[model samples]
Target: MMMSRCDAEEDPSQTKKRKLCPSSGLPEEMVLSCLARVSRSEQASLSLVSKRHRSLLTTPELYKFRTLLGCTENLIHLCLHIPPDPNPRWFTLSLKPLDRRLVPVRSYFYQPLDAASMVAHGCGIYVMGGRIGGRASSSVMFLDCRFHTWSTLPSMGVPRYSAASGVVDGKIYILGGWADIVV
Candidate 1:
């Protein structure tokens, strides 16, 4: 006699359980962590392979597992200035680990700059004065990573370009740069 595809053939002598994931032989939670590390682009293809993959890929619990595993994803932000366009445009690209696929994000900072000093504080990227039309600039711009917006901060004492800047203990420090001082 032949059984249907959905039917499970069983024997009274065989009571042992079968492994869920054939590749890893790990628990479902551990398996999810392994799957979470895969790039987002591949997750869609992997989902098509099996029902288990689809469930794990779409569920939020997989992301929770990623957090538990301390997998911190880093995003790369790039600022571009094109001629004729007055405002500088900001773009962000997300690079997936292991797979190394680039995913572009919608958010951006609306500010134009030829050269500027950038410093990261917490979740903010601060843009200090840069050279504009062969002159030093003192305009301070702040880019908030959380909301993906730009705001102006108090200008520095002097206009500087290509200045050195850093963040320490939540404080931002701006050092000497190409400043035009007429004595």
Candidate 2:
């Protein structure tokens, strides 16, 4: 007996059978809508199925999930690059309830020459020691939101880069980092 086109088909070398989509049939838009409800990772996977599927999966409605869920506000720092450079430009963003827009607090424009270790607490930002053009910098810059000014403070223990910092009980703590030797 001959099998119909819609019937399961098997390869001559294999016993397993495979099913095929009905001819002239189209995937329901509801299916894509359902897929859009999945997580971002899953949506990205669905996009790989086909060009049309990719387009549907990456639509603004689907990609806006992060922003709608308030996840984007948790990001503290953003490293942006202007291109043509191997390193990314870094900027610290303020996510305080009073401040809705991301603020460019600090950057690495003078990196290798001047590097800062910054920590934000309350409404203020603290930046520690850095070097300028291979010379150790003893300057400490602080940003006062209330005053909206950058002021110099007491210098740090050492001039460094790639350092970590945190605030505890209104005091800033500086952690491990490379210190430049001044001649």
Candidate 3:
């Protein structure tokens, strides 16, 4: 809402004109293009620019557009766990935009699954069954490394811990890690 389009009133005494996006006086598509060209590390900082910019950056369309424009880059994710810590931590190597280092991702939304099997497929990392609270879990979660987000997948038929898994020809294969209870 550059003007009075959204009914959001501005000071009548002010005479300055407002463009589409206050940050960049460009169209939405062009803005997205420019943002797509920015390094992954800098994207998070850009999100603080404005609500519109943050929303636009989070959408899947941004990455798709980046791919179409050949502006994508390689990113590495590192996961580490040490004794005395309840869960493992995830980090990504940030190699651009003035600050280049391993940046920590806020993974609270999707708590780490201890001993969970992980396999990389395209832009997603699948976390298969593992122990949750010292008990076997049947839940499956998918992590979109692009945005450091996670989504829950259908739970497995049987709970598993320390499962062995992999991707074969676009299909996932899980072997072992389930047990039967006998009364």
Candidate 4:
């Protein structure tokens, strides 16, 4: 019997084997649901297990699922002043499954923006009222943790640097700082 071009190719149904996923052979959807329940702080470790896990852990769908399931976790971010570097570096402390160590996070910096007041609220770090080019500035910027991006917000009424800021009842209050005295 002569074999035709189509006959030489194996039937997909016959050659394909059922793939048992790493999650006990459960479907991808179910695995994602279980993984989504993990605290966001620990997702980095999960992401290192495999490429599939990394893809699933970092997807927007998984984050949305976490929100829908009420599994969101809050992280504490701190700006550390390292010697020889005037610009402060941002770090986040993981909570839940609780990690006390600080993990470095990405942030944008503009020269001469030191002494800015920073406060965290609703998945964002607000940096407001700082010195720009060695002069008092009223510029306001926020870093969105979810997207790791920076955006500008309305500037404060007056330029202030080295101010104290904190969140009270979800409201950010900027307290006293050095202000430019006009002649």
Candidate of highest TM-score = 3
For candidate 4, write residues 1-183 as lDDT tens digits: 112486587677844453445746665656767887886666666766887887676566677777888887677767788899877777778775646777665454432268888887887788888776778989998887764457888989989999999989889999999998889
> Lowest lDDT 10-mer window, candidate 4?
104-113
Candidate 2, residues 1-183: lDDT per residue as tens digits? 122486767575543233222331333333434554554323434555766665454345433444454433332544355468744444444555654444443331333124567777775567676555555555567654322345667877666765788988887788877766546
Candidates, ranked, lDDT: 3, 4, 1, 2
- By summed lDDT, the worst window of 10 consecutive residues in model 3 runs over 12-21
RMSD, one per candidate, in order: 12.0, 18.1, 7.1, 9.9
Model 1 misplaced regions, further than 4 Å? 1-73, 80-88, 98-109
Report clash pairs, candidate 4: none
How many clashes show up per model? Answer: 2, 0, 0, 0
The 10-residue segment of model 1 with minimum total lDDT is: 101-110
Task: At residue 97, give the lDDT of candidate 1.
Answer: 50
Task: Show model 2 residue runs off by greater than 4 Å.
Answer: 1-113
Off by over 4 Å in 4: 1-62, 68-71, 96-98, 108-112, 167-170
For all predicted structures, in order, the TM-scores are 0.51, 0.40, 0.72, 0.60
lDDT of 3 by residue, 1-183 (tens): 123457767685553442355567765766776788887777767777888888787778788877887877677777878678877888778555555587666574776688788888988788888777678888889889876788999988888877789888899988887553557
lDDT of 2: 0.51
lDDT of each: 0.68, 0.51, 0.76, 0.73
Best by lDDT: 3
